[model samples]
Target: MTALATAPTARPRPARAWRAVMRLHRPALIFWGFFVSVVSAVLLWAYGPGGNAAAAAWQRPCTVDLCDVGYAVDIYHLAYRFCEALITFLPVLVAVWAGGLLIGRELENGTAELAWSQSVSPARWLATKLAVPAALLTAGTTLLVLLHRLLFDAHQVPKGWNWSDNGTFEANGPIAVAFPLLALALGALSGLIAGRALPGLIAGILATATASTLIGLAGPHLVPWKTSVGDLKEGYAAPSGVIYGREGAVTSTGAHIPDPCTGAGKACPAAHDIVGYYSEYHPSSQFWALQLTQTALILTVAALATAAAFTLLRRRTS
Candidate 1:
């Protein structure tokens, strides 16, 4: 009884921390909720009424002069493009909020320091900062991704839509979820490094953009490319696929060389000692492999950024 009376009362630190975070970022939280709801509704409409109307428009018998595709196609196209663009660039938006408002503004305005003084270590503060947003971002992005996939898989998208297209590919897989987390991590690191809101916002955006660009460029090479070879008379014989890596003449000695007959209509393959033509590309079957590979890479970078942020925070505080 004496010990109990002398001891300090236990407190729910994590719950308190979570509540504090939510209260501080209430505006951003509201905006995020609204954004997700709007996109989800758009996707649902496209998947149901818009898709049916578009399908019916396509099925209409064509007159010689005009297809008469109707407004449904146009509306569906607009909806799809809007959703794709938003989902694809969701990370940049996250980066902006994170760097500008979440970490940078707090640090810039002495809010973080005040929190640290209130029996909350810098580590715990940072953890709450990252974890709360991370959870929300993950949930929201995952829902968007699933909706996008459902719409795409319904086979009602425009004719030119391909699984390998950048927006479609990212939105259709786990990379959609992974990228925003990366953006959040990057934003946090930028905020810690800059210690100011505006600079942190710019740096975070550039960093996330650069990382995304690099990953996109490397996506084609993430898996083994399928090759199709054909004799000179048959010309190039590659099947339809994404990322046509290489298309050139194949010599009898199995060496690759530039195709001399590419533009010349009557050029002889024999002049270039070309026995056949080869094309290297990624087939549709490689989609999952590529997506998973990119997701792993992005997550790895996010982890590194998170570690760097903690290290920077510790150095500053210590």
Candidate 2:
């Protein structure tokens, strides 16, 4: 009788907060990450160097006066290659949208009061909610970067370049790494502050886009010069070739100079800034320090911005 009366009750299991988060934002997450991956792969395969047979074009010496340039790789490969490169930014976008969606939506809807009334602490609830999406973003980023590196290597395409074409690569910079994370963090905060999911997500995307533009704009001065045309001799030419040194971003009058990079029968001394375009090195080398320092500075700015955001998050809000 006593055993029956005093039967112990089993403790209720703690609900996995991440499960709810995943259920809520699964569509957006998938759309941003996996969808991008699949589309990128298809685009690359169909129009990229990987499937040249699919994108083949007949090319021969131009018989007509003022015909197109020589037979070379199709421009589609370059275009598709840039499209696939968008993968690098997907993680940040997904992160911002997913992280900020629910929290803000709930707050806007007044559902968060019910949650607060329950046993969950705001920080713990937030952490659990952010975890699942963050894991997915991390996974997406790793897979995308790896796949890109492998595919670019296979295709012999220029794998890394400043997305902004600012003459530097941000593949190793904190801006590239932090951009999406900043978006997610901002989105999550927006969810809390913006009071609705749609607003939060939009805010996340806007903030990320703005930051990306800044990074891209700043990329040209951020990396080492992969050899400048000005660094080359005035009439330098490769062996058995009549091509000479290219003119750089000199502030000379645009009175149409000869094309130095041209061949004997082709145009010569064409006055144009051919600096930082080719993947070639020049003589009298000694520009490594400038590039390295620039990279460090830009990356430092990115890191500091992220740190400031986190620091503010840790503070008590009114």
Candidate 3:
């Protein structure tokens, strides 16, 4: 009797906040898992059976006038396009999930408040929410990027689908992982600002879209753009075979010039004193450099957004 009376009760364990987060967003998790599985299967098919079919189709000479100008729409090409679109649009999907299905729904339905009331700090709750999904997103995107690079290296890519291509560059490197994280961070910030489901969803999508547009516009300037000066009469062609940048005329004295004429005529050549042209481009050798630089910038933006989110949560909770 004395032992029973003096015995201490075991304290209840702290709530498993991460597990609660997973439970709250189980549907989104399921969808993401299904999507990753399907994409992995498609990529594997591209590397295996589809590759053989595409190779066979490429060997057949074209009898028509078009000839090799256009390759046949083979299974491999289809798979390649599928991978491109999948990696490219992944960020948007992340935005939607983070906004509507994660925080938006919780905030709208008062579940966030309820969770905070039940022994969970707002910051910790939000951190768990962001951290789990971010880990999964990073893993999924990195796997897809690796598979994409493998497939691209093993076969002949379409003329415009090289490393210099926008979709190709994004899908083949760390940018694939970084961009989704940026979208997720932006989505969370949007959700906190809007505080309602539909509005938050819309805001998140728009925010992601805006970030993408800004990046597209500003990306070229971020890296060291190589300017190749060549004879105007000889015409300028990229030495590296990849030219994803602007071209304009330059004088013998290295002064910048603008061409007034549109068509290729004698007047067009003489109008701007165009002795030569400068082609600003990123060479194939700079692929990894540009990718790493862009990734760092994107991650920085993500970090800022995440910090802002915590601050916002703190203010609201306080």
Candidate 4:
């Protein structure tokens, strides 16, 4: 009965799912926007007026070549503080928010059940929750990182704040982005496992802190280091921005020994017949290569956490 050729109505599942996630997490969305705005303003000030002031201060009238270290310290500390916050503490904030506000709170308050009942399966719901926040987090972190790189490269930032610094290393590269995602996934897994907002938040913070410590300790080991062997008299001078690893002395008999006596005055090398000291280091040129490798490792951790989260979600819902 070719009654009437009727087309099937389209169901905007993805769009609706996105909207539902936004609606559910409106407060978090607002808070994230506000935080990003504040950080952006700080970066802008550093890039513009604050930077100009620092330069002007550096140009202080110097007959004997001495300048106002206090003024410079004041100007630089603020910028350093901001960078430090982003690199060191940003992941903790992400984990807390993801655990307490995003997933845990919803599960705690029973809103998750209500959402799931309304045409959203558990997997789709979890995916939307993670996807939306992950996208926002990525955008925000990338912007801050770019601004940091620009400021540092332009020499607007202070000395002693180089790529090798823990805070600077993270804020200057892609690992900055990866760490936060790992935090988010860990937070979600924590929330699902705890099933309580506050406990989830606490667990997430601890997990993120542990991850950061592990990553920092593993930093130099992430890539093969370049080895340099020089006569002990030449001394061990690592390349600028290179992460130095093991140091040892080599004997004239071709035997490698560790940490032999060194210094322009030390006689242990002559007594022991040491020819040279060898040191392992990763040069500044390896920055991006090592950064990407660490990022891959972090993302792998996040992926595993997300998979575990999905499995847990299935068990809970079933």
Clashes in predicted model 4: 0
The C-alpha TM-scores of every prediction are 0.91, 0.58, 0.91, 0.87
State candidate 2's TM-score.
0.58
Q: Which lDDT tens digits does candidate 1 get at residues 100-210? A: 899999999999999999879999999999999999999999999999999999857449688877688889999999999999999999998999999999999999999
| Ranking of candidates on lDDT, top first | 1, 3, 4, 2
Per-candidate alpha-carbon RMSD to the true structure: 3.5, 8.9, 2.8, 4.3
Model 2 / residue 263 / CA error / Å: 25
Please give the range of 10 consecutive residues that has the lowest summed lDDT in model 4. 67-76
**Model 2 stretches with alpha carbons more than 4 Å out:** 1-6, 36-49, 52-79, 88-92, 95-100, 156-177, 219-318
lDDT per residue for candidate 3 within 243-286, as digits (tens), equals 46787777767886664544777776666666877777888888
Report the number of the highest-lDDT candidate: 1
Q: List ranges where model 4 is wrong by over 4 Å.
A: 1-15, 64-66, 69-73, 253-256, 260-267, 270-273
lDDT of 2 by residue, 61-139 (tens): 4566765533334454554456555655564555455435556667667666666567766566666665665566556
The candidate 2 region of ten consecutive residues with least summed lDDT is 236-245
Whole-model lDDT values for every prediction: 0.90, 0.49, 0.82, 0.82
